[model samples]
Target: MIKIILLLFFSLNLIGCKKSEPVKSAEKDDKYGDYYVESSIGDATYLNPILASDSASGDINNLIFNGLVKYDKNIKIIGDLAESWSVSEDGKIIIFNLKKNVKWHDGKSFTAEDVEFTYKKLVDPKVKTPYSSDFEIVKKFEIINPYKIRIVYKEPFSPGLISWGMGIIPKHIFEKGDFNTHPANRKPIGTGYYKFVEWKTDEKIVLEANSDYFEGRPYLSKYIYRIIPDQSVQFLELRNETIDSMNLTPDQYNAYKSYFKNYSKFKYPTFGFTYLGYNLLNQLFNEKEIRQAIAYSINKKEIVDGILLGYGLPATGPYPPTSWAYNPEVKDYEYNIEKAKNIFKKYGWSDYNKDGWLDKDGKKFEFTIITNQGNKSRSVACELIQEHLKKVGIKVNIRILEWSTFIHQYVDKKNFDAVILGWNLSRDPDQYALWHSSQKKEGQYNFVNYENKEVDKLLEDGRRIFDEKKRQKIYQRIHKILADEQPYTFLYVPDALPVIHKKFTGPEVAPAGVGWNFREWYVPYEQRKYEMSK
Candidate 1:
């Protein structure tokens, strides 16, 4: 998952500092008036929601598209484009009652066919969507009427009801095109509150209010996502008041807390975790014992304290501490250098010449860890780990790549021996794409090639289970299994520090974090910066 971005084209061209006098809502009293700007580090790879797996694309898609169901402010599974829904007692069937009179941004009527088309595309083997696992269990898709449909699953799938929350695509536009070259992917037209305006590649993306939005028009006249690559530059833009909000780095948050007193600063646990993933396909990491030894050698608490500066928690396993499925009883590989060395010795890893490096089969134990540039926490964590592991005769090289290049050349192709990366977490705990061995196809989410018959079985069982208590037990077992296996040394769950201009109001903290009620946030007329409120 990725956030939105920023650009230099409009620097010092938009708004004023928050210190400016508060004024009345004379410019955009009736909505369609004010514009809010935000920043993103990486540019969007695809605007097509289903085809896009990165966070930047997902964030933009959330605005231009509407899922059938979404998490409410309190994190409850609630209806969005779907007015209501019902589940069969057996939990194998779900029928959705889509909202009536809903129209796509192109003025086309939204119907059950759109949802059906979206689901079919997801499950199509020809289509390379990472989300196909959720739909593959479907026994069949039944359209009862123009505004109603029933989805019958082969088994009692736990995520089935919430899985329909995938954004619906327009079949009329998507069905006939070369999927990647489709105009809809770049300039999308959806039934959500925001209409796509323009995307200037790496510079900026703009969206305007949709008057025919099912819920009603948004309070802001326009929403702009700017592409500012450097976090420091983004903070400067935040200070200069060129952007309304941006996710702040821990250092930036610490420094600007008092400086941006007039701004609305929010601190909450992001659902995701940063990790060091190993390429199991590589010969160096093919040994599970080597991976387990490395896990015991490093100090995760040191990274949490020294790198994150107390803005996060040491990640124990795949699930974040906040998740109901997170198992606190998983076996932890605490920092122990001697124990790591003992494990290494038992596995035929040793430094016979005392050259301060471990070697086996005449090959030195050395590998590189690549991570995307612009993430300070990740870079720092790698640097610290390099130092920590070097003491144990392990050679680690660090390489930072540009965002787009990193994903396209290294991650998607599984070219690196190791990588320090982050996963944009799913609200639902079905981590099939990130962990399932079958999903290791080219361009798929599970690029690491992690495979265990037990993990696969647990994931399958957990998804098919409808009982919350039962699912929790299965996930807990999976967590313990993964913890013992140590595919990725589960790192840290950083606290998201997003600071927004105080002029924007109506934001409240909740289980879903902020931004769920963004459509309701409005700036008073006197505080409005642009006459474009027209």
Candidate 2:
């Protein structure tokens, strides 16, 4: 049987060789085929635009789905399915007009009813979407006609238009079932440039161009998203030409920039944060002085320059540098060991020899700093912090857990002393879910247990302040207050490194995420020829 199989394979190879001669003899090249993109994360969840968490997935979802209003690279609202909109003077109502020509990838007309259905379905408490909170302030959504809709607000909402960021779902698919676990979620239909083709589990998700798309058919006939679990393996795939593009860490970016000099790279500041959070529920950490000491004790510059290898900026607060509301005037807790010691001493944790740690009333000051496992860099950062804090007679145990446990259990319960985590800030300023006092219950993400009337008021005021300048001022004050309270060790704002093959071009890294202009981006045909020639 083996001999027969080998003989058949050789015969087929011989036939293929004979067939290739005529093509080479003609000296003709085939036209570009498709754009193939690869990344570390798999399609663990389906490509439902409403549910995607990361930027790459979100970008692709946006290509497959159209929001009411899309943003430009500068985050300026541009029309997508919504041709235009009008905001009421009182800021409580917004009316939008749907584009009549748009059609879903499934060939359904994109209508205002879909927009209304999306908001109504998500915000309904029965659905239990984490993103439902994004629309909490919305009171009602009314479809006035097939091409028009009106949004009524519970109160003033500054970033009301940002609601458009949630890709409108087709009412036909998700009319029933909690969308979080819906079967339609696994196979979403949207009115963008691409159509869902097939998902090869644990391997790749394929998409074909939607020729009937309103903006004209995409240049690429197909898009293949190869799923590679490990970052190292993903990079290796890029090197081996098995995959074309992937997001890289700073270290990986630097390594590949040198090794694959011909390849292209798109680096941009992420609208996300990486911070060392204080578990304020812990008795030892409840003290404001101790918290401030811990914040000051962290060498942020070292973490940014040494650990992150100068790929990120020192975080001022929870938000990134490019946020419109980011306040430069806010105070940052600088690295000051003496000051940290002074604060620790004032907090009565000065005794150095009480069971290999600092002590207050015979109690040893020791707690674990938890972070997600499988991240070597974060683990190293935690270890370095553990050593640094030890110098101040404080003992920090590092407890690394899987990503889900870290986020849902440790962070939600506020069970750890400190945590290293990241947050992808939403387009709107309603951070109540993460920062409000009401979210301190277990399974919620208010890790700090931080509660301040003044700060709460500032956040509340900022959310309603439509004026961008006013909002900035409010956030500046809020940031300064948070700095003083020391609820978290504001660490570094890391940039995303998307390593792409030289053959494919135009993965622009904007502030929000990579591929902000994904709709119009095209990989030049010349590179396609080069790839085929090779």
Off by over 4 Å in 1: 1-32
Clashes of 2: 0
Point out where model 2 deviates above 4 Å: 1-32, 41-60, 198-203, 350-354, 360-363, 373-376, 408-416, 426-430, 438-447, 509-514, 524-534
Q: Estimate the TM-score of every prediction.
A: 0.93, 0.84
lDDT of 1 at 274: 83
* TM-score leader: 1
lDDT, residue 446, candidate 1: 83
Ten-residue stretch with the least lDDT total in model 2: 1-10
lDDT at position 129, candidate 2: 39
lDDT of 1: 0.79
